[model samples]
Target: MNHTQQLVTTNPNLTHQNQVQTYNTLTFSEAWEFFFQGKISKDKLYSEVRAGKIPHLRLGTKILFRSATLETWFQQQELNSIR
Candidate 1:
């Protein structure tokens, strides 16, 4: 299995169907457009990635994030703000 597949299996937030949806990971632009929905600015996303506040993977010079991971992170952020 590949790294992405491993993430799908390990992430509890992903249903079997969602696992298929996320078989391919997301790039910064895709994640920003699809997952974040402009609630977070592009610069802030990059800053969080640099600070390791967001879940991500580094492949040489590239940064990748799984959709399931982003969903979970967003949910956690929501919960945190409520507390």
Candidate 2:
């Protein structure tokens, strides 16, 4: 799986050591690892994704996820369960 690069500033105070940190939005497997605390099987995760129950993105033919957004989705799911 390929990762999309994200540029983030590490330190704003240090001008001389200014550097941009590169991060990859989570892959399908990596993202699923956080889903339901990884209690579900990979096949089940894929099924959920296919059923549109989980949030994900398709870049061309590649499935990907934004960890922050996915986490928020999970939080909402938890809240819904409570209600």
Candidate 3:
């Protein structure tokens, strides 16, 4: 089996593998860094997140986003732009 299959079959009780963990949410700085390779100004990143142009999750007053969701959003954007 490949690495991914092996990881899935591993015992769930073992934290070393087979355990998938996700961040509750990413801060603006954290999320921006993932998409952008270089330095990004805080003001611009915050503006984009606030404008609803970016995908995000809001829990009460807190803001968070799943990494996988962000990736899916990017893929959709690419497909839409191509058509």
Candidate 4:
């Protein structure tokens, strides 16, 4: 199988996690991966930011997020589902 196919078939979850780890607010790719993990579509991410559902910091138009915040958000989602 091709490299991309091999990656997809083996530990798909890990692959995604790795992608998420590769970036932060300092890198666009990392930010995209984090949003992707949250299952937020690109359009939806923008919309949520616009609507104030998702909190972000703006440094002269550069958006940033804390990794811990994303982790907490995911944990809260899990907790809500358990109820």
Q: What tens digits encode model 4's per-residue C-alpha lDDT throughout 1-83?
A: 65644553465576555544443442333455544555667777777667966557777867777655665676887898999
Candidate 2, 61: how far from true, in Å? 2.8
Tens digit of per-residue lDDT, candidate 2, span 1-83: 22322222233453221221123366776565544447888889889889998888989877887766776787899899999
lDDT, model 4, position 14: 61
Worst 10 residues of 3 by lDDT: 15-24
- Each candidate structure's TM-score, on Cα atoms with residue i matched to residue i, is 0.67, 0.64, 0.56, 0.57
RMSD of 1: 7.2
In order, what is each prediction's RMSD in angstroms?
7.2, 8.1, 9.0, 6.3
- The TM-score obtained by model 1 is 0.67
Per-model CA lDDT versus the true structure: 0.79, 0.62, 0.61, 0.59
Ranking by lDDT: 1, 2, 3, 4
Question: In candidate 3, which residue pairs clash?
Answer: none
lDDT of 1 at 40: 84
Rank candidates, TM-score, best first.
Answer: 1, 2, 4, 3
Clashing residue pairs in candidate 1 are none
Clashes of each: 0, 0, 0, 0
Model 3 alpha-carbon miss at residue 58, Å: 2.8
